[model samples]
Target: MGGNGKFSRWKISFHRAPSAAKKEPPQEFLCPISNSLMFDPAIVSSGQTFERACVDICRDLKFAPTLSDGSKPDFSTVIPNLALKKAILGWCSKTGSGHPSPPDNSEIESTIRSLSGSGGTLESPKIRVSEKELLKGVTETPPILLSHAATELNSRDLNLSSSSEESVIANSTPLLPFATRPSCFSYSSSPSTSSEFVAEEGSRNTASINSSSEDENFITKMRSLDVYEQEQAVIQLRKKTRTSEEARAALCSERLLLALKQLLNSRYTALQTNAAAAMVNLSLEKGNKVKIVRAGMVPPLIDILKSGYEESREHAAGAIFSLALEDDNKTAIGVLGALPPLLHELRSGTRRSRHDSALALYHLTLVQSNRAKVIRLGAAAALLGLLKDRDLAARVVLTVCNLAACDEGRAALLDVNAVDCLVGLLRNRAEFSSESTRENCVAALHSLSDRSLRFKGLARDTGAAEVLMDVVKADSERAREKARRILEGLRGPETAEDGEVDWEAVMKGGVTQARHRVGKSSNRNSTEF
Candidate 1:
């Protein structure tokens, strides 16, 4: 709400009006997401503009960031940003900003291919291992993944015994003694062990492929008809992907995600919950987050939120909360109709559901459209209802602060007697452990008071004036500043309704009185002389 000596609602203005007088092109000519002058600016469903290709890639990947107001751009429909595009073209002609040509379709495709790993994304790195470990890996106390990795050295036709293995030394000569590379051959020097070395060398490529094959088989099992097999598959998936970043990355491809998405809608309670839990585990790997959503996991997850089993709903919410943390997944989740159900869970679901749903809402609401949607659905009243218990107060209040940013949110909050609710929390601040609750209480009140005439009376009625003054004197600087802003608004009315002066009447009366005094004085002066 910071403004230039005037009241302004919170808006994310990434661009400014172009003035031909200025030498530089106005910031609005560029796309915020791409940080480049827009050549083909296009508006998506939320009425925000970006480079057209940016939108396409985002949709194809099912990735978008949450905008500031808690809503995300919906790429389902697009309109050419004709006006802005025209202005940008005009400016480019005048200023000659020397902007480079925007990327072409082929370049964009290449980027998509690279990001999705479709275009030469795989690279088989030479596995690094010590000589001792390479020998130890085959005997198998604990399997060494690096040892099992394909060096493909046999394809090079290098008949390396122990001397040649030592000679290669990791593609560099100096680090030979300490570092060794893994491949199809064993690190044996004796001519007698040549067969053993060759056999070991040959197994590396097969082992690596089999390892990859084993992970793919998980998807097939997950989609199996037998319930027990599906259950076991989910269990093994959940257990394996839980701690292994490698496993999550390898297992969370398109087919596996589709299979998991199917299980998310499973009528069986245990399978649904386990699948959801495994999703949460998989999403823990940063690389898998966007890919999971790209595979269309969101719609099924929403199904779980709506009518899944009690235990499953929490996992569903947990998965959503996890995915929402990713910048790209935020929009897809919100756009796919997760917002209202999440708010529903926040209000009436399990303790865990309530917790995760609250968090999901916090991220999803960053876009303006989503904020309005939640407020319209009565989120303000629902959130205020949770404040009755101080135990839930601190956690839920962060989201309350977010809701207070918009006009609808503030109005909705005020309608729900939020001023009174927040003031009461401030009065008993010592009872709560989190200063943030008290801080947020003051902030929500500050936002309410920002441009509201009704807030003055509400604060005066709640004795918010005195409580805020105390905070300004004693609370943290941040809380105190917001308290000061609210207090400033509460100082007094700007003008009195019934206290206007009758200036015209006063002037006429004054002239008549002066003339009467002059006539009386003239008569008296003649006699006195």
Candidate 2:
């Protein structure tokens, strides 16, 4: 990862090659880059997997290859596909095929050169006029090379962190379901529901013409010189995009993204706040999340969060939270130094800022890298300090639960004697607080109990063992299950070994179970067998 703020800066060198196999390998096992068995598979940020060496070769040549699925792979960052590599090797062994070796970097480069020479060039998707018509399939190649997207974005002079991959055909499952958008955006009771009203007139107005004309009209207005015009355009765009899923998708053109990126720097407070608010609406649509980040909005948004006007800063935090919903954007967001400000927001920002920051932290903390980044930010202490504020405690507790999922987070939490804070929360079970807050507290403690050797002692010292027993009978089934496990862990292994089973009774129990379950009513069932 590079500090130049360009998103596509991950660098990994790979060199290996094997002979062509006699048998055809699975399509997915073959790197999209090499079109051969991949000795080393790596995932990129935009949810595409490729060979490690092949990605390097593309980076070396400053190429962004379009896939068979018609979408461009965001080669901003890459991670070793340990699971996929293991699966590929196992498949090779099962079929008695030789293991795939990495092709020499020179050989891969030569192949790319030949392909590009034979008309494999691509237009930048960012500036494409018919942005909506860019077919976004998951695989395939255009017979053309694309100017590396990162190069074009670097002209922004502003920069941030790198990127990575997501899914292949076989690795299509997400770790967690994106069941809801950032609820803090509208202060809605339901996670996915919006309190904002849909723009019914826009729907009726766009009934005759497609969204292209409407989108262009808005993009044109958004980039206008007049602050009054720009402000009006942003307000309209924000309002239209708020609850219109169609507007959100159709208006997410690269031109519009770039326009919004510029407006985020507006000197006028109203327009800047509107830009941030529009960003939140746009990001609610799943397709726009990664696009918004790639459009270079992150750097300016981070700037706003760090020192913008109070109202706009609130929207800025909300925008960042919304963008982080996509798993691909999580790493880049954290690597760009979002953690410290977010932690600061949790400690001092307005109520909404704290809530959105917590939500963003919750999603960002899901990955190990971000967890470690945030832990290094002294997040454990900051989050624990927020527990006293009941309004923010629910999300704060949930975010802590995410942190507890990783070993580093667990260590950090334990360092702060979080055992006492969490146990007290569980024991008190504030009458005004939501059950989920206490449930998440239990969940965090449970996660800590799993790996920390000192956790049992901490739990017993805080009277966590007794508190957990009470939670075991509480309303939340999940909380109860976790509480039961924590209680069992606190009991120690010695208790289980002390109790011995009666062999004679066990043997009788098995024979008695077989008598009723083994056969239907029959006098000679055993004789028949």
Candidate 3:
């Protein structure tokens, strides 16, 4: 039995026959990858058993196999062979050499017997189990055994039953009660009334009953739908998901997100709209945001933004806005060329799409490199076009401020006549406009004022001087002070030596004025624009 392998000691040795008296290890128990008796075995899609570690190694190579038929199976299709794993565990327990301790198998055996006839043959249920029937069938056995039995019985269903050819079909006669069905079993909390005998097994049984009920409901809904009806069903499901946080979280599953990504390419406008809407809600979570972007959702989202229905474009822009929340996603989206489509949305989409697109650009331009990319994509001109939209004015102003943080951005804005737009916003000071929007507009103009005497001359040329004078009398102290400083800076001498209005002193005075407005004398640091 002492072969030259790591698992050599675990092999079962046997003599061929009485006459031959030659020893050979059992082939069925050996793992193909390691060529030794398996300690932890699993099955691949090819129906071959290998040590779990070997399967993982194959997965790392993308499951590329040097096979005789040149067929390569996807690594994702590999599944754990629970029956073989348990058999090995039991064999080790029986030998008392491979296993140090083993769980109780007697309860597992009893649970199996409860589902079988006196002769050990399973009995098919006459009717599907209902909620009341499942609650009545709660067992005292460990859930771990039931989970393994489900896997084992499933394998037996393929091998022993003649009616079905699929390996995963449950046997015609379920080995366990439908209440304890593996497809939907879960662990739940015990009832508050049973404080004395609140066993873990009872809690698990209760959870399994509830889970089976939910599974049945979902199946019934799915079974009743045709192809077109299914699309509508998904739309309704998306609406329901928006109202429940837990449902939104559940939509974050990789399979579901991938499905949504595929649905982005659907010919049906309603399907695409609902899929994008669902993804917008799903991407609210940080992890799901990363997953949605990584699933190649950004490009299709941009496409939807380009030419989808009115509501679809809004949802697509909303999804892009959510994905832009992460710093890494901001770069990923930009690298995927999201800027152009976002700018396109700003220029021509509905008012809501323009607002959401501005928000997406706001986050993306937070990265300094993306600022130049956005300006290059003609964002400066597009933002200038949206400046008049009162509904989108504040976000459009904020995005301009972010882009105008640098000289190149300022130059681009000046080239696109953004100075005229900013001054126009300042001129009216609409009663509906927010204080933040006015502040952002002034901040962008101030950054533009930093470039050169020529650009400052450009501000004055764009009637910025008269607008600043008007803004100087506004109610907000910060707005008044920023306007006065720009007014003085543009009007004062061009050289730095000209007692040129000390910027720090001016900012300190502005903060002082702000504190004075609220009647606070305590000194505080001046906030950066």
For model 3, what is the C-alpha lDDT against the true structure? Answer: 0.54
Per-candidate TM equals: 0.54, 0.56, 0.51
Candidate 3 residue runs with Cα over 4 Å from true position: 1-226, 430-433, 491-529
* Decreasing TM-score order of the candidates: 2, 1, 3
List candidate 1 segments past 4 Å from native.
1-211, 492-529
lDDT of 3 at 145: 19
For 1-529, candidate 3 gives per-residue lDDT tens digits of 3456635543423322333443333565665544556654555534356555444334422234443445443333333455676776676565443531211123322333442333333343212234344334444433321111011111122111111011112211122222112222221112222111222323232322233443344334434435454454444344434323345445465555555666677766556655666566566555567877887889988888777866677778877877787777988898988888888887787555665677788879988878989877776787887778765676677778887788889889888888888888877765434555676788888877773666665774676766776666653566777776776665443322244333343344442233232332234332322
Query: After TM-score superposition, what is the CA distance of residue 343 in candidate 3 from its true location, in Å?
Result: 1.8
lDDT of each: 0.61, 0.62, 0.54
RMSD of 2: 19.7
